[model samples]
Target chain A: MKLAYAIPAAGIAALTSAYASAETITIATVNNNDMVIMQELSDRFEEEHPDIELDWVVLEENVLRQRVTNDIATEGGQFDVMTIGTYEAPMWGERGWLEPLDDLPEDYQVDDLIKPVRDGLSHDGVLQALPFYAESSMMYYRTDLFEEHGIEMPDQPTWSEVRDWAEQLHDPDNDLAGICLRGKPGWGENMAFVSTLVNTFGGRWFDEDWNPELNSEEWQTAIEFYVELLGEYGPPGASSNGFNENQALFSSGKCAMWVDATSAAGRIYNPDESSVADDLGFAPAPVAETPKGSHWLWSWALAIPATSESKEAAKTFITWATSQEYVELVGEEEGWTSVPPGTRESTYANEKYQEAAPFADFVLNAIREADPTDSTLEPNPYLGVQFVGIPEFQSIGTQVGQQIAAALTGDRSVEDALNAVQRSVERDMERAGYLD
Target chain B: MSAVQTKRPWVGVLAWVIALIIFFPILWMVLTGFKTEADAIASPSLFFTPTLESYVEVQGRADYPKHAFNSITISLASTLLALLIAIPSAYAMAFLPTKRTKATLLWMLSTKMLPPVGVLMPIYLLSRDLGLLDTRTGLTIVYTMMNLPIVVWMLYTFFKDLPRDILEAGRMDGANTFQEVTLLLLPLSMPGIASTGLLSIILSWNEAFWSLNLTASKAAPLTAYIASFSSPEGLFWAKLSAASTMAIAPILIFGWMTQKQMVRGLTFGAVK
Candidate 1:
């Protein structure tokens, strides 16, 4: 009986001691390559701080967004750290859902972050999140195909030139499409590309008074051009293809040109991953009636949620993960080509990175030039080039994207789709009280 | 006899064709799991060197055994709990004839039609308030509630088909309600109960949405494990396939092993 009592007493004491010493911080992150690398390298952070344990909850992008948003809104205290984007950081920061990231150790060099990238993650002059990597849109084309076809791509091509190039290079008999673009129906999938197309074609989602302009002449022209281009020269089942599908198609030598996030440059230029790595060329994202908002600004960043009990430990981990030292560590451990790019100006200046990534300067210039605040041709009530930074934009954008995808798949006419998009947006804005 | 044999051969051939067609997607997934990432995305072709590289990478990246254990524990527990609650309710509805019994059964099923997302916030908040978030116990509870209606409905159907005379005889033999259910109803409805349990187990195992929302690292199951492979930048098709292959392997084996029993239970009342 004494032995049994002592055994239960010992177990209770052990459990109490174990609970008293260590602080485990849970981080909810997306399953992107850079975030995965961070997870792999997190052992160093754990080893350095023995008392602070790390628990990772990696989820897919949309699921991660949903989980984090649900947790933060309810103050469930499930996550200490969250991987959010430019769209959510500002909105959430303004709502005081995120912890302000203004205070950091001096050597962290917060100013080393690119202006546009950092600015996108800030709200009202306060930093809300630290950028893991930033990106802009650019055109990736096949150099060999262009050369063989005797076509010279300009430094900055117009949409008309791109269409003509696509027409000339299209070879359906050879199972090669002229261009691969995102057609998956999501707010961030097809709409991201479509919004830029509309912006460059002198259109906006909403005018200055928050009235939706989706049925405007500019939108009609842009939607018509998009459907015609993808329908004519795109691969079969293009409506189901998103960034990943298009990336796979482009990297496999099936696509002649792919206009997508500049962050894909690393994978597109890596010979191990891309079959056409040696035959790739880079150009600015295509323009139409205007140059404004031709490219989008986006940053995937790490932020501490207000509901965290382990805020300090989470902050420490975030600082370590997004620091310049982390960049150096990734470069040393995984080659220079695999280092997270477009976050810090110092990364572009590094001789090793510049040598490994020849398109660094081009990508950096595009990121610098993308202005989220003034992304539309007309005056608009929202920020974001590819997306509007309002909370309601997700559902609205996804609805419009589905309609646009219907048009792309020949399930609906462009005019009808745009009209439906306008009607939905109007209903949504009215429901959200954004419009009377 | 010769004419019957010829017709039987054609029926067998037709069955085989249908079975292969039904199985083609799984075969394609397993095949894609063995291909390199590049080759997986390459034009559909049967020729490619099979590699264990994706399996190696997937195992190295995630703790598969942990996720498998969670899947097993949560699924088995939820199914068992659902059976415990459902068997009694189904027995009552089948044997007892209250005027509201049918309406009550329909109402229970109607709750299933409401989208899981529609009540996600309230459930999430309730779970948090009750300190049930991220616990296997919490997940088992939600999954039990989520699958309870179906389990009840299935068991009710099976129990209804049971001969009312047997239960009536149990009462006539001076047995109480409990004794009647245990001695007469349960044993007689064993096959039906087994089928309901099997279905509940399968549904709980493959459920992703609630598991993804309600649980994080501590109690996450194989569904969450498979979801981790999907990235925003691109899908690693080969790795995703390998992860999926690993996730579904145990369930597939379990299903195959019990398929005979399941088929027997399903056909128990059909002929009669």
Candidate 2:
């Protein structure tokens, strides 16, 4: 009996070590405000689920996308949970690289997630990822600056009216630029801002038949308008500026107005983060001929990789991260302004959050109103509002963005830039067999 | 000497101005680290409410020590491995004096001309196949391959500058092939070796592409850490500068301490 009991005990010890090895899960993510909060609060998660261990690979937006894309494509299995955007969730899910996350725990309140955010992050009605924060583009202006200048900014100011206001408020001598905008040449950098501008100007990347319309009169007008506005009133070295650069410009009270993501409302309102926290005024993204696609929709969501060996552990961590409890935890610890916004309806409906964040109602309204399906004035065959939802988009959009940057620098005419963009995009589309 | 030199105080002032011009960008980045993100980008000037907010945020954002640890491991490991491989190869080319040796050196250097992106796919697949992706050992191996040719060329020049008669005497003293090479050749080339190692470490530490591509969680270095501060919409100047300062601090201090050896190696054979 002693010999038999000793053999089984030895076997149990062997199994325990193997089980310990299996408990650790690695997650690849972007370094966003919410993700950073998750990293800090992970001790709570680890204590509650002591059987699971969390490993994080936090990278920048572009680098994270490239790393996650390479990992999933190669099936390297380096990370179990990947922080993806609304752009990648559907594409990667269609490629069978991501696992379906439909069977979340009942308490996760899957139905409580905002429908627009959830649907954008799903494919064929099967949820592929969970939203950490979703956002639509909106205008953030300095209320103090406007009030001091005796300027009245309507909630729905037209783009023409915005430009007039900017010109009126311009004071380069005061170290203040009338506006701040992205000028860095990347698909997601300057192109994100430019795409929304193009939409509002009644320009589409492609027509219904998938022919590139970059050289059209509408696109020319948009490019010219952007160049003129920035050249006249934007900060110096504008060609090198991207989102973070522009964010710094805006938050310092140097920018009279900025049009960017609703996700930034939290950061801009935090007293610890922004100098102009109390003086911020929110408005809808400005429009020209069309108001339909004046804003963009984006969700920075988390998904599990199909090749993950520790699937259960990964899923558990993601669920905890995107849970309603996590939102409340962030509010309690980091303040309500820093809480992950535009993801769940509960966040918007909470009186505590509404009272805490003055920009809450405007951000929610913008997010809810953004329609990705009809993001352009003309018909087109793409899903994203600020980006074309295809693998080749990274290459194509970047090429166009370079031309736009060149135009900004006066190295090329707006017409020449648009002409080059039209030719390159059309050639690429034809080569890719998207057009006959 | 008295009249011409005394008349030109403006020349010294111009020299100082030139030095300042060369150093401005780095000084700007350092100064930006102390400012809040808002102030850093808004004015691009020295006037602002200086804050440690970005540094605080940067430290909390990621494990700086872990990344610094990986950087130290991979850079030192790769430099040592490359030295072991290149010293012998360079010795053969320098002392052995074959007609094909010059061609071989040229061929080795030519490999550096190929853009990293051109061969990224094959190398990435190979790393994956070998189960080396995201491992410190894997990065060391890749970095060794990447830095080998330059190491070989540098070591060869240093070895060539050594007195051939000293090596010949060691051979006559029955030092044997290994001893003559190890004891005599290595020590004589110490200045060169130190500088080469320093260069390799600096290059490997600053390399962003492979570290970003190969390593996700486990073996990420300071380059990837600095890169995480950049976002799509705009650049976070204060936080990025803070990350950059942290990333560059170790190597900068290392360089300062070993400046003598680096200068000796760089200026090797120049006087002779």
Candidate 3:
């Protein structure tokens, strides 16, 4: 009888020990380098808040988007914190799916966040997500090759001038292509670059009212130049290249120039990763008729879902992760070059970050100069520079991206591709009731 | 005998070539796992010095043992549950004919035609309501349901090939249905059952969609573990290849061990 009583007493103790003490919050994030670093240093947060435990669910980018969107939309309450992007933050926030981040601690320095980056993640002036790291597109070229060929790149080059340089520097016999650009067909893959191209060519996805302008003269000019430049001077099988593929191609000294995300500066400048690290140069994203949206603004931020039971604990973790102290910790441990960039004004202001990252000012200016609301020359309805803000834009953009990729591959003419894109976009907008 | 001997050597050469063609991608993956990140994407060369750095980094970054344990447990439990539910259904469908039996079997397969994404929302919501999300039990149940139709279909075909005379004789000897199944049918169809279980386990082991969607850290399997290496910036090919090699090794070994049984069972009724 004494033994039976002791067993029940021990069972109760075990049960209480498992459940009663601490709150556990699960964070669903993408598997990016900055997020990985945050995960590695999360033990500090756990130690500081002894009454709360943390769980991490790291997933790939596309998979993370799908899972987080599903969970939040269904109110499944699977993740307390979600790593979302500028594209989803405002849309989801406006839908009342995200908790407004209005009550952060005093030391969190919400005002120190870059204005454009901060604005991108807010819905009607209410912050929905905290920017962890942000980026804008730029041109990376080989200074050595430019000197060898006696070619001078402009501070802000035009698309026509860039094409001329490509024609001059392309040396297929020596196995070096003039340029490497994203040609793979996904909304985020090739269309990210293509959208910027269309913008600088004075093209918009829609007019004042919602009608697709894909078959406009400006779009045709932009796409024809893009396809001709990449086809004439790009490396073989360029149609299969995305950011990573083009990064690899450029880093190995196989491409003379690569126009891609400014986030690649760290990898490109690291001597261990790139063969041409010592000979690299930077310039603003090229333009033609305008520079209004010559570069894209993107930020991968963190937000708390409205369905989270541990909202307070989750907010504490987000504040800690995106804090200036966290930036200092990363700089100290991982080196200043590895610091997450484009989020905080203080990061760009730091002498050490400026010294370590040479392209810091250029990237910061580009991020600031990009105006998503007024991206195109004409009045438009979209709130994104590289993407459209509406939910239906994802499928529509991907369909148009495929048609553009086909033009690059020579399977279809540029005119035919744009016509098909216009038809598809009209169909999609009509189906989504965006078009009457 | 002389002509057969001459033909055998040429056939052996052809077989070796075909085998190599089929196995080259796995060989390349293992080799790339040993290369540096730059070397993996650089011009394909066979002369670089091999290193174990990627394997070290991959292991350092992830808890491989936890994911491996999850994969093993979920796959085995699902396979056992599928077998338990499939064997009786397949037996009844094979031995006891009814007018609607064929239609029922076809309908069961038609459920598979609907893409998993079409019903993903409802299933996700239901799992959340039931508090089944992120649990190993949840994954095992999903895997079992996903593989049940194929398991039942394979078992039915195998059971249909069995001689009805033996079952009738067992019935004549005063044996009931349970006794006949336990004593006579199971022993005679051991190979078939083993192969069906093996296929179910393999399918569940490599399943990524539901595992990625339904499970968080606690019950994530090797597929989810492999996916975590893919970043928005780019894939680290050497590290990805290293993780892939580790994730596939155990299942590859398990498949090798069951190869003979699978071959025998798959071809059992074909020759007759």
Model 1: per-residue Cα lDDT over A150-197, one tens digit each: 999887899999999999999999989998998999999999999999
Per-residue lDDT of candidate 2, residues A134-237 (tens digit):
99989999989889989888869898888887898889999898888889899888998999999989999888888889999889998899999998989888
The sequence of per-residue lDDT tens digits that candidate 1 reaches over residues B59-139 is 867767667767877998999999999988988898886999999999999999999999999999999999999988999
Number of clashing pairs, model 3?
A: 0
lDDT of 2: 0.86
The local distance difference test score of each candidate is 0.90, 0.86, 0.89
Docking tier of model 3: it is: acceptable
Model 2 Cα lDDT, one tens digit per residue, B1-272: 55865899788789899999997887888889999865775646778777899999898777676677778778889999999999989889888989999999999999999998788788888999999988999999999999998999999999999999999999989998789899999988898998998899889989988888888866888897898787554337789999999888878877888899899989978896
Candidate 2 lDDT for residue A90: 85
The lDDT ranking, best first, is 1, 3, 2
Question: Which structure is stronger by DockQ: 2 or 3?
Answer: 3
True contacts kept of 2: 0.41
Candidate 3: stretches off by over 4 Å: A1-22, B1-7, B46-48
